[model samples]
Every structure is written in C-alpha cells, then in structure tokens.
Target: MGDRNGCSTPGGGGSALSVMAGAVIGAAGLAWWLLSEAERRRQQPRQPRSLRLSTLRTPVPAEVGTGTSSEPHERDLHDRVHELNQAIDDVRRQLESMNTQA
Candidate 1:
C-alpha cells in the first residue's frame, strides 16, 4: 500500500522522531513519579522521641506527689498533702522505735 507521506512505505524516516518522542514522554513520567515519591516522604509525620516511655523514665521518689498545679484544683491537693504528712510521721515513729530498741 502507501502511507500518508506517499512514499510507498519504503524503509522509514519518521520512526526515529517517534522513538525520541516516546523516550521524552517516558523520562517526563519518571521525573513526575520521583517528585511525587519525594513529596510523600516529605509529608510523612516523624516519630517524636518524647512520646517514648524510655525517654521519660525519671526516677521519682516514693513519697512524692504527682498532682497538677492548675488553679481550680483545691481539696485534692490539700487531702494529698495531709495524707503524705501522716505517712511520713508514721515512718518516723517506726524508725525511732527501732533506734530505741538498738
């Protein structure tokens, strides 16, 4: 038959242009994919070191209080302080008794 160029379909001349165009399109698609992957990595949230238990492992004393110091916190703090003082007195009496026995 004959192509639209009317050359009777000999070898081919425009085939190289088609190959180059396809290569350009493929390269552009690859570039876009790489950019999208990079953007996804950028948008990902990072893991906070402070949220880990090991990072917050401070040695707290046994008789220490752990109440919030906000305003509106009234009776709870007073009750805790009173209870802690009683416990401390009880321990002191026990230690004094042991010392007297020795």
Candidate 2:
C-alpha cells in the first residue's frame, strides 16, 4: 500500500478522500452529459406528416315520393318484402336438403 513519496498510502485517509472526490466528479459529469443529451433530443425537429384522403361511398335510400302516402301501407309493404325474402330462403334451403338426400 506504500508507494514511498511521503504521501499517504492507498486505503489511508488521503487516498480514500481522493477516490471519493473522483467518484463525485465522475457522477457530476455523467449527470451533466445526461441533461445535455436530453436538451439536444428536445431541440431536434419533428417530422411533418401528410394525411391521405379516403374515398368511401355510403348507401342511402333514394328520395322519390313526397310524404302524401299512408304510413301503415308503407310498413305493410316492408313487412311483405321481408316475408317474401324469408320464404324464398326457406324454399332454397328445402331444395338443397332434398338434393343432398337424393
């Protein structure tokens, strides 16, 4: 531990104090570097984005007749159309079942 220069040996009070001072300076340097890096990151310019427009069509009912018609008749027509579709589907399913059995 004694490198004879009349100075204190390694692991003595002076050496220990010197090592602690070195450690403190190192830590302070690391902290300053981190803060400067953060500042540099904040100063960087952001990229501008271009928004592309989408073309999508939505289906809406055509306005043909004005409101002079009976509401009950309109409802009856809608129900009849629905029932016809169901009947057609049932007939198709029965035909498919019969064909498979055959």
Candidate 3:
C-alpha cells in the first residue's frame, strides 16, 4: 500500500527510521541552540545594582522647627518619627512656659 504522498509502505524501505532520525536530529539541534543561548547570556556582564531612592538611608534632620540644626543622623523611619514628635512636644512646652511667664 502507498501513503498519502504515494510513498511505498515501511517494509519497502527504511523511511520510518529515516524520519525518526531526522526528528531526533532536529530535537538535538534545538536543545543545543537553547543551551548555547543560555550559556551566552550567562557569560554577558550583568547590570550593576541600580541605586533606588527607597533603599537610600538619608539622615533625619535634627530639631524639627528651628531649621538651624545642620547635623543629621541615620535613623529608621519609626525612630525618626518618634524623634520629630518629641521635638514638637518640647517646642509646645517651651511656648507654654513663655506664655505663662508673660
């Protein structure tokens, strides 16, 4: 019997084996290409770690309102907020004392 392409049956020739070998070679080539591409990417120099504003540890300004303090200290967000609140309270107290004296 003949196939759709009018090719004779597998018993007439080793067409089946040839097709299988071609498929195997194609698969191997694809795998090799993928591996080489991966290796090429691995060899390329990676981009340097980009600087992010969020990651930066900018020093907190000292004494909230005076605007005169130049010294800055590296403190985390929570601690810096606490310090600001304390400075605000201190200023309030100072204002009250001045008012009472007046």
Candidate 4:
C-alpha cells in the first residue's frame, strides 16, 4: 500500500513504477539489438546465397543407355562399349579362321 505522501514503499507486491521501468528497459534492449543488426547489414549488405545443385546420375547398363535415352555421357559410354564388343568379335573370327587353316 502507498503512503499518503504518494511515495511507493517498495513492498506492495510489484507497483506500477516497477512494471513501467521493466517495460522501458525491455524496449531499450530490443531497440539496441535492432540497431546493431541494421548497422551490420549496412556494413555488409546481404547477398543472395548461392545454393549448390547436386547431380544423382549413375552409370547404368549400355543397353539401358542406348534405346530411348539421349544424354551425351550415356550415349558416349554406349558407343565406346559397342566399339569394344565389335573389336572382340573380330578377334574371335580371326582366331577361328586360323584354327581351321591349321
């Protein structure tokens, strides 16, 4: 309870003055934090962050690559495989021809 002279006795269980003081201090703290952030942003303006994109491309079978797919890496791989198979077939034919001659 306050005295007749209008002075708070500080034991009246959270007087209006304490509440006002707490509100003012909280407001000042918030204002200070906002100003610091603004100053930091002004010194180094926010840049657009670049996100890295990841590819999940894994090599499948050559036959799987050749039919309907048109990716360059897959097509190249399929062609190289086809060339190797053709070379192997030619070597087998030559060896058979030699064996027959013997």
lDDT (CA) for every model shown?
0.75, 0.75, 0.74, 0.74
lDDT of 2 by residue, 1-102 (tens): 356754566557787789999999999999999999998777654322111112123343455577544565799999999999999999999999999999
Tens-place lDDT digits, model 1, residues 52-81:
555579654343356544423567788889
Q: RMSD, model 4, all Cα superposed? A: 22.6
lDDT of candidate 3 over 1-95, digit per residue (tens)? 35865566555458777899999999999999999999878766442223344335566445768654543433466678999999999999999
lDDT string, candidate 4, 19-77, tens digits: 88999999999999999999988766343222111122455435454465557677899
Cα TM-score of candidate 1: 0.35
Clashes of 3: 0
If candidate 3 were superposed on the true structure by all CA atoms, what would the RMSD be? 19.1
TM-scores for every predicted model: 0.35, 0.35, 0.34, 0.32
In angstroms, the error of model 1 at 98 is: 90
